[model samples]
Every structure is written in C-alpha cells, then in structure tokens.
Target chain A: MEAYEIVKLARDKKRPTAKAYTKELLTNIVELHGDRAFGDDKAVVGGIGELNGMPVTFIAVEKGGDLKERVYRSFGSPKPEGYRKALRLMKQAEKFKRPILCIVDTAGAYCGEDAEERGQGQAIAQNLYEMMDLKVPSISIIIGEGGSGGALGLSVSSKVYVLENAVYSVISPEACAGILWRDAKKADEAAESLCMTSEYMMKFHVADGVFKEDFSDFKGMCAEIKETLYNDFVQMKKEAPEEIIERRYEKFRNIGVFAEKKASSEKGDID
Target chain B: MLSLTELLKKSKNTIENGGRQFARDEKVKCPACGKEEYRNTIKENNMVCPFCEHHYKISARTRIRQVFDKDSFHELFDNIESADPLEFKGYKRRIEKARISSGEKEGVVCGTASLNKVKCAVFVMEPGFMMGSMGSALGEKVCRLFEYACENHLPVIGFTASGGARMQEGILSLMQMAKVSGAVKKHSNAGGLYICVLTNPTTGGVTASFAMLGDIIIAEPNAVVGFAGRRVIESTMKKSLPDDFQKSEFVLEHGFIDKIVDRRELSMTLGRILNLHREVI
Candidate 1:
C-alpha cells in the first residue's frame, strides 16, 4: 500500500491507530509505556523503532476513531499519566542516545475533572521542561490536529514538520471566532486568519518543513523522511552536549522581542 | 423612558469602546489631580499624570514601544493564520470582521528584540485584538515563540492583557493554560528567565498558567489581575467583595504578584533584572 493509503487506513481504524502506523513505517518497534510516578496513560504511546535500520524513539498521540475506541484512548487527549509516560520514554531515549520522533495529533490535553485532580498541569509542565534538556536529537511531526498543551507536551523538537493538511494552533479556530464574534460559523475565517495549516506554519518558521501530500509512493516518502531525519540528527550531533542544551535553552528564551526606550525614573530600591 | 433607553445605548457604546468616554468627557475629572485634561494625562508623563502621578492605562502598542529598544524589535507569528476546527456557526465571518477592524493577526504580538541592550523575547497581548483572547493560532505562536527562545538561549518577557481564554475554542482554548505554562517551565528550567508583566484585565485561564509563573511577576499599577472577575466571584460565592479585590496592589499584598510597578519604570526594571541573570551569557 502507498504511504498516504496506509495513513488513511490507520486513520480509519477504530483501535490501535499508533500500532498500525508503527507496524507499517518502522522495522523493529518496541512499546514503552507509563510515567513511573503513576499509572501509564494509554492515550500517549511511545517506543523505540528502527527507521531504515537507524534506531529512533517514536512517540505519538493515539486517538480512537470509533466511540468505544475514543473512550478507551481518552479521545486522543492525554491525562497527567499520559504526559508522565511520554517524559519517562523521552528520558530513556536520551539515555540510549537515540533520536526521538514525536507525532502530534491530539486536540488538546485531557481536561477532565479527574485529570485536574491529579495535577495535569504539573505533569505536562514537567515533561516540557525535561524534554528541552534531553541530550538526544528530537523531531516532532503534526500528523493531524495539534491542539493546545497536549500537542505541545510532545512537540519540543529541533526540527518540527507538519503534514500538508495538518493543523496546529493554541486554540481551535472555532473557539476564537465564537468568543470574539459570538458566532462559531466564522471558524473558517478564523482558521484562515489564524494560519493553522502546515503551509502557513512553514512560512512563520514554526514548522521547519511541510511533507508533500503525494504519498502515493510509500517507499519514496519513507526514504525522504529517513533522509531528513538523518540530516537533522547529523547536524544536531555536531554540537557539543552542552552546546545542544544551551541552544535548546536559547530557542525558547528569544521569543517576542520588541522595541522600547529605557526609562530614567525609578522608585526607591526595595529593601 | 425614551431618554433612559438612549442613555443605556450610549453607555453600552462606551463599554464597547473600552471606557474611552471617561477620557472624552470634561466633567469626568482626574481622580488624582482634578484636571479637566485627559490628553494631558496620556502625554505629559507617559500615560501617567505629571501632576498627581496617577497611572493611566496604556495600549499594547504603546507598551511594546516603551519597553523595547529602538528599532530592535522584529514581529514574529504575524502571519501564521488561524482556522476554525469546529466550523462553528458564524465563527468564520466574525473573525474576518475582527481582522479587518483590529489590523492585527491575533490578540497577541510576539517577537524578538533588545531591551536596553539586554536581548529578550517578548509577547504583548493587545486588548484591542479580540480582547486578547487565546485561541489555537495564538496559543501555537506563543508556544513556538517560547520554543524559539529556548533554542536561542534568550530570556522571555511577556506583557499580558487578556480577558482570558477564548471561549469559542471551548476546551481547546482552556488547554493553552497548560501548553504555555509548560513552555514557560521548560524555558525557566533551561536557565532562561521569564518575566511576566501583567497589564489591566489579565484574567481567566491565562492567569492560571504562564501569566502567573514568571520568575519575577510584575503588574502595572491598578491593573485588573485575577483568575475570575469580581462580579462573578461575588455572585457565585455570595460574599461581599474586598476593597481591592483582584486589583494589582491587592494581589501584590497577597503575594500573588511580586510588585505593582508603574508603567514608566517597567523597561528599566526589566533590563536590570535581565542583566542580573546574565550568568547564562
């Protein structure tokens, strides 16, 4: 089957979406689950895999297409346990010196009352912080909808790629339009204005690249991804461990700089 | 009855325009100085009264220009657009109208710039842009911007003025709280500094996340900063409100915020703090 056809097939499946994709895309895949602080979350799935015989860690959000499956996977939205599991896997991957490849497709983090009771925010935050300093190369691909913190929890990477039709944003377009105009029908306009598409993200430097939709040739697509992954890994490996850590640190520190004049006045210094 | 209806409509207009009428009316004198001039208040002392030192509200653009180094700021996430994932009713047209009117890509303007030679990443939320709501695109940009900063090893400074999470996005909007907070924690743990400057009307989910997670939290004098509004809390809890409920000073007193610095001194304070954190450099 073609790569696009396989993705379509996986998308249509009711159970084991991540497993299906992994079986097709990877050679030797091993499943790793659980955060260790708590129980494992099935919504987030991670493991070690071989792409063209090169070892890599694969993490992806698992969404159930059917009602039963969705309930089983928590509708692709992870709870605290899910994030913890991802973090554990990420740390393990770093220890093994293998590159990490994350596939983001969740609508957002699980916002159930139960999730909050377990300190969902803290769990997600911990993962994000840990992922930034991981010594291994990391890449994140938005295969579908990358929504909110749930997506971000798995999305800290040196090279981020988005599928042609995938959407990534802070809040969904419908929500913004609804809140601003008291109308949800304006969501298309909101989407256009928001630039949630991969094409737009590539322009803004949010996405390093956009994968071509022509997955009719599954082997070619796989080879291209492998090449891109290798190049990114080679470049990342060139930097010293400390340099890599510092570079990741700086990547987040330099957001949103603007112009302002220095002020002369000041209240008395605080004691 | 007719006059009352007309008065109600006028008042609604005033509210819609974000309390601009108080500045226009000659009878509405400055509470601090008894001055009839409102423009004077806006101009003579950088959105503060020269005579009485009363701090006035500053616009997002004004705040950005005042704090960032001259011509050192470059806008990012200005064009990565938004999409309505739900295709909710009338959401598409309304966003178009907002884009046409606000002349902004979204509620927040994110970029990189130098503050008094101390380079930092900045995000300024414009109340004018859909009340500075956090939607998918806005949330993505904020997260990506932090990622960019983390990669570059620069500190992040945010001037926040949000009405809260955009309700239209439903659960997705609320998720930004965790998303951005996660980013902030990542940036901080990497030895990067995060300074959040809370402006007027910073409330809702935003207050719950990165807005309150700053290593050093600063608010403009008298800015409304809280998780929930005074009226809603009063109604829900059925209790009398305190004199300074949710006000900047009140939050400072309670340790929810570090200090209530006047806007004019914001840039210098931030610069000094960033310089102190220069060990990373």
Candidate 2:
C-alpha cells in the first residue's frame, strides 16, 4: 500500500488511542485536570506517571477509541484550555525536576469560535515559547496523527519520536485538497502528495526515531516506549539545568536544517 | 430575535451600496463605508480609507519602504527558488503569476533593516504571492532569518499577511509552522527581541505558529487575525458568528494583541519600540 493507505490503517477507528498506550506504558498513572483559569478540556489527558521508578509527567491529546468517546473528546482537537492545561503541567514538571513525555495525537488544534475567542493561537504560541525553556529535559512521541499546531503545542522538546505507522501533517489532506484543487474528493491524491508518513517525515528531522509497530505484539511496543523513557531519564537527570535548557534549544533549532543535494543526485534540497 | 429574512433585508440594502462587487470603478469604494474616493487618495493615505479608516492590503516591497529607515533595508534569502517536490498541479504557473505581478520570488521576503540604525530582521509576506503561503522555501527563509538574528543579536520584526500554508506544497508547507516556531524559540531563548505585526487577514497555520510568538505582538487596526477562517468556522459549526469574531479589536480585547497601530504611525511606533528596547538592554 502507498503511504496514505497505511495512514488510513494507522488512523483506524479501532486502533488503540493515547489513553490505551498510556495505560499500558506508564505505572501509577494519576491524571491531573484543568487549566485552573478556565474549565477543563476533555480532549487532552494530562497526568503524572512512573517509568522504572522514575517520576515523569505525561500530556497527551486524547482521541477516544469509540464513537461516543470520540464526541466527548472532540476527536482529539483540543481547545485553548487543553493547551493551557498542558502548559500548566509542563511548568510544574520543570519546578519539580520531572522529565516530560508528551504524546501528540490530535488531528489539529480546535478552531471553533469559542476556542478562538479564548485565544487558541496565543495558547499554542505560548506553549512553543515555554517548552523550549522548560528547565528539565523533555521528550515527545507521536503515537498516532501529529496534526499541525495541535501536535506542535505539546511536541517541542529535547527529543521527539513517532510510532512506525503514525502520520503527521501541517494541514490534513482533506483540507489541503479542498483548498488547493477545490475538490475535497481528491483527498487520496492530496495524501500521496503530502509527505506525512513516518518514512517520509524522516527527511524533515522533526522526529528523532520511529518506534516499530508489532500488532500481534502490542505489549512489545509498550515495552519499547517504556525502555526509551527510562533511558532518557537516566541520561537527562545528570545534565545541569542550564545545559538541559541549552540542549533543548539546540535540538529544536536544528529542525528544518537542509542543504542542496550533491550533483550526482537529483537537484533538490534535503534535511 | 428578529427573523432571518429581516436580517437579510437589512444587509441587502447596505451591501448593494458598498460591497466589493459594487466598489469596482475608477474611484475605489471603501468596504468599511459607502464613501467613494480616488484610488490615488487611498494610496496616498498609506492605503487607509480616509472616511472609515479601513487599512487596505499593501505589497511587501511597499511595506518595507514604508516602515524602514530611508535606503536602509538590505534584502536577503531571495536567491533560493521554490522547488516543486510533488510536481503539484499548476504550482509552477502560480509561481510565475506571483512573480510577474508582485516582483517577488516567493510568498515571504526577508531582510535586514534599521529602525534608526537599531538593526532588526524584517519578514514581510506579499499577499499577491498566493496569499503569502508558507511553503518549504518560505519556511526555510524564515528559519534562516531567525537564526541570523540570533547570531547577530539583532531584534526581529515580522509583518504577517497570509491565508496560511500553501496547499500546493502539501505537508512541506505545513511543517514550516514547527520549523519557524522552533527558530523563534531559539532567538527568544538567546535574549533576542522579536515583534510581530499582524496585518489584514492573517489566518490558518501562519496565525497558529511564529506569527503569534513575538515578544510584543502588535496588529494593524481592524485586521482579521485567527486560526480558522470565518467561512470554515461558520460552516463547520453550522451557525452564524459574531461580527468581531476574528477582527483585531476582538483579539486585543481578548488579550492576544498588545496594541493596534494605525498605518500612518506604524513606522514611528516601531522606532519607538526599538529605542525603548535598547534603553532596557
């Protein structure tokens, strides 16, 4: 199958959501809620968890598994309150010397009138600014779809990862088709044009590594994420706070770094 | 509440007098009001309608000339031509049209300029260039400009006027949001100052990303700044929206915008900001 055909599978309605992955991967998970300023947004799930005895904070956009839950979660399109809640937790993590592991799975940030009225654009931009200076180290993993600013709100960190079958795009192919071709039905063609699959996303240097999926061995996949989390904790805990912040700065700074391809290859730019 | 027909009747009479289709003539009509003024009169007033004070969309080059110190702007990052990775339909043709009409190579133009010799990087998006979309080439230029500012310790000023990401570039255009935001983060962490001036109709991915990351965010008076366009939000939610839903005044009231400046005072205001920043440093 082509990349987007696989994207369909990765985005399967029955596929386990962020909540499922967190349940399997983290120990002693305790979800914290609310932006404190506004009421809580159900779309994002935020909490504290343990990985191999190491304390960590996990923030994720929840794409509920079933039709009913999907409506409840707004299909993982988080409103401004959700992003503010995540920022609130990220600051807490920094103050308490906890590493952050954010799971990005939203189709995009909420664009409803009330959401914009509450400052959705500013909220995401604030997250981007604050995440870079988060005193402690942080990592982000795209367990499913990393959609535009929705995914980015929680994913600007020291390291970023993605599941093997996950897809990330700036704008969804459906919207891109609708806007570009004036024919939303050409979404399949738009998907092919968008370099959204993990394999294609590799060229952008956005995600550090891909966690290979084993459908028959889902537990194995959980184990791998846990292992990576543990390893990051061990190494990141030693670095000085300033060094951690600086390294995180450099990590994000290095994205979109590209150079012209050699004369022997096709004449183009590659990251 | 008034019935829908009453509302339609009320608007139809007004729209006939001043709507865009009714405004085309040797003398341009102001959308904000029913007044008609000579085209030269509007342009002479820095493209602000004299009667209603509506700010008209200005070109990137014209904006640079209007804002910077006389003869002090040096253009950068204009050499890189946008490559069509997917061989997208009519992408090249769009590029050609933008180039011929606007004399700009891409959607965004980046360079160094002086606000009274207090150096800063300026990025102005040309609305004519496919509504100043963020394709890979534009993204790379913006990222590089941010890095340049960081390396040189110069403050940055950005003028955003875009419809959002370039659909022709697909995901590549979208990824620019993260890339540019990352660049902004680095510049900010390095103690560099950045100001973003939001212009008319700044929407979509552009509004969601670096456009909002400025240390001091300013907007043109009455500009429309939001994540989703008006039509999308209305259709998706299946309801009419507030008149001020995406307008700059609403954003200012809601706390995203620091201030709104009139077109005539923008340059002086920027110079004042740059001077104040220097004193603090």
Candidate 3:
C-alpha cells in the first residue's frame, strides 16, 4: 500500500473512532471526566472499564468519525486540558493498580495561542515524567497518525503497538515537507522518507508490535487485540513495578543506536 | 569585519535597518533597535543588544564560555561522529560542514563541568550545527552524560537551542526524544538536579522532551520556546499571533518557564541557584 494511502486510511471517517473502539473492546463502560486542574476535554475521552472481564483504566485521544464530532473534538488535537485529564486518569489507574490502555490518534497537539498560553509544553512534559514512573502497567496503541509529542505524551508505555494502517511520525509529513523543501506539496515524499509506517516503527523498536487489521470485521479485530493485550498483561503482571519502570526506560533508552562494523578501521576500535 | 567606528557612524537613526538582508556580515543591526554594532561587542555583551536589550543568538562555544567559570568546562564526548545511517541526500556533507562550521562533533557538546565550583554535567546545544537538531549522535552523548551524572550524583545543566529532531535522520532522529527523556528520568529518579536553560529558538522535539522536564526551567530573556513555529501556527490557524507569541516572556507568563534570565547574568544566576538547590546528601 502507498504511504500516502496509509495516511488517508488513518484519517478515514468511515473507520471507527476511539469511542467506537472502546465500546467494542471494553465491557461495563463507566465514563470519567475532568482533570482537577481543568474542565473536561472531549478530545481525550477516558473511563474505567473491563477488557475481557479484567479491570482496566482506558483513555484515548479520538477524533469523532462524523463531521460534527470531528469539529467538536478538534480532530483529536488536544489542548493542555486534554493532556491534564489523561494524566489525572492515569494516576487513578496507578493508584488502583489497574492496567492502563491508551488509544493514541491525533494530528498533533493543538498549537493555537490559547493552547500555548495554557502551558502545553509543561503539561506534556509532566505526563512524560509521571507516565514513566507510574507503577501500573501501561500500553498504548497508535490507532492513527501518532504525530509528534501529542502522541508521545500518552505513549510512555511498557509496550506500544501500532495498527497496520496507522502512521507514527515525529512531525506531520506536511510540516516536515514545509520545513525541509519550502514546499508542503512534497508531503508525499516526506511521508515516504519519515519511515513512520508500522513496519518501520516495529523494526526500529519504537513499537512493541503491529496489529494487522481486517477492516471489515471490526469486532474480530477488537477481540484479537483484547486477547493479545490480556495475554501480555498476564505475563507483565509477574514483574515487579520497579522492574517494569526500569525495563520501560531501558526500552526507550535503546531505541536508536547502532555501530556499522567498520571491518577494523585504520584508526582503531577505540577511535 | 567592520570597525566599531564605522558601526557607530551608521547609528540607529542613520540606518533605517531597511530590508537588512545582507548574507554574511560582521556588523549586526539589533532587531529591537536599529543600532548596528560590531559582532564582537555584541558577543562580549552576552549577545544582547546594549541599546535596546534585544537578545541575539550566540554560538554554543560562546554560550559555554560565558556561562561557566573561566576555563572550568572540560569538554568531553567531542569525537563521536554522526553516521549517514539512511544516507539521506547531502546529509553526510552537511554533517562534515557542520563539524567545521560549528567546531563540534554533533549539535551538542556534553560532559562534566562546573558552574562556579558547583560541579554539574553540562550539555550545550549549538544552533550553528544544523540548528542543533538531535540525531543519534546527540542522543547517545546525552544519554551517556546523564548516566555519568547519575553515577557521580552530580547535577545536569543543559542549554538548548534547537529547531527540532534532524529530519535527515528520519526515525533515528525521532527516537532521540525518547532516548534523552529516558536518560533524564533515570537521573531524576536518582535525585539529581537537572537545570535546562532554553536559549533563543528552542522548539520542536527538543522542547517536547528533556528541555521541559527540567527541575528548573530557565529561559533567556526572549527565547523562542515552543513546539511549532510561529509561521506554522499562523498558517494553520489562519491568524496572526501576538507580537510576543512563543517568546520567553510569553512562555514564562504561561508557567512554561520558571524564570527569564538575561544572558549576561546567566552565569551568576545559575551559580546562585546551584549553590542554593544543592541537596546536602
């Protein structure tokens, strides 16, 4: 499949949004709202529920599937409020020792003047530190374009998975094209080069796994993901909290390092 | 290089600062005030325009020299070269040029140094080197520095001036955000201090991670500290931003930064903070 086509699929309105996925994946959904610091953000929909009869705290940055919904959710580009709400819910999960599931789908964080005024960088940074230290097991699924820090704020997880159709990039390809080529028209080329496809993410160890989807059978896909997550959770439950945090840190620390095996250079190995 | 006499002759009133787009010149016309000052005078003034207080970008070496005690910074991790991992077009040549132009291995120079006798691990990101973008080389050096600091129970002080992750390195550049942040967390968990000073133009992935995670986030008087560029935001929102948007004053007002320190006073200010915040362990 073309990389640009993947971008389109990730944004397809026909596909189920995070809310729909939540409904399909979890049972007895009890919704939660509001970070103590701010009002609720519709962009980040979070709740506590059961996945395959195991209790879990769930949060997702989702752009609603329809026009009205998408406009209301601001295309899943969260403001500082949304991140604060997500962090609040994650803290609750850690307190209760529940595994946390985060569905990440966003163009990126909101970049409006108001968002900036509300301390967006600090909000995201707080989540990065808190999530890294959270005692509960955490997992994130890149359901769409995991763009920049918006996706990363929710994805400091023990394990991260990306959907086959999802694109995970440091910056949107359009933005990348604009900065590099002085032309946003070259977004397709930028996308091709970002190596943000699920295959590349898994190869680079940025994500733990990729979920191949059968778009027609949404129920089956949810079930498969649930089973996989459940088994992984079962295995992870055996590890201590400190070890889990350390392992997650190490996983991230080792993301992009390699030596080219220089066939014994003239200067020597130490050089 | 133009002499100060010539620069003074073309004073603020005389020079309209019109278009002022000379490609490369030793004389700089202050942005806040149109006073054309010799580059050396501006550098000696800590890169701030003396007439109008407009802060100018300084080289990473100058930044290190100005902020640390005289001859105290023992620069290490200087030889690690960035590989053309993906061999993106002109990337190797660009790295080679950056080496000669910036006089640094990668965008960042990392190692142990002291701030007025308060020892700390220091990493100064050089904007001259491809806008100090983080690639695998920068990331590896930073991660090692944090580990080194943790082992020694020393503090970490970082001065950031970056556009973002190196797009030429692709996913490898993006991973630096995670790698550096992880190393930061390791140090923080060990109860080490990390002071991040956001100088002019700290943005993108660098701002999103370790830069903002500092226990004390100090920014220069007017640093452009933000995630997205002003143009990007303006274009996306179809609106012009406020005059101070993403400037240090704006970021500080929004509680994103703890304080805004003038470049000239950074050394003394940081020394005081380091002494005051030292854990009596």
Candidate 1 residue spans exceeding 4 A from truth: A1-17, A214-220, A246-271, B1-209, B212-281
Model 2 C-alpha lDDT per residue in residues B23-82, reported as the tens digit of each score: 444698888897999886776787889998989888887788788887788888776557
Q: Model 3, range A1-271, lDDT digits (tens) per residue?
A: 8787788888787767788788888999999998888678889999999988989999999898778988899889998899999999999998898999999999889878777778777778778878888888889999887888888889989999999999888777787788778899998888887777998887778889999878788889988998999988888878899988888887777776433234453221111
Worst 10 residues of 1 chain A by lDDT: A253-262
Q: How do the residues A25-83 of candidate 1 rate in per-residue lDDT, one tens digit apiece?
A: 67888888788877888899889888768788898898866789788998788887888
lDDT score at residue B114, model 1, on the 0-100 scale: 96
All predictions: root-mean-square deviation over Cα? 11.6, 8.9, 6.7
Q: Candidate 2 falls in which docking quality class? A: acceptable
* Residue B43 lDDT, candidate 1, scale 0-100: 57
What tens-digit string does per-residue lDDT give for candidate 3 at B1-281? 86654444344213312222223548878877799998767766877898989888766666777788766778776666587665566777887677666655578888777777888899999898899998887887788899989999999999999998888877777777777887888898889999999988998888878889999999988779988778878988999998899999998877788999888888998998898886641
The residue ranges of model 2 lying beyond 4 angstroms of the native Cα positions read A240-243, A257-268, B1-26, B31-34
Q: TM-scores for chain A, candidates in order? A: 0.84, 0.93, 0.94
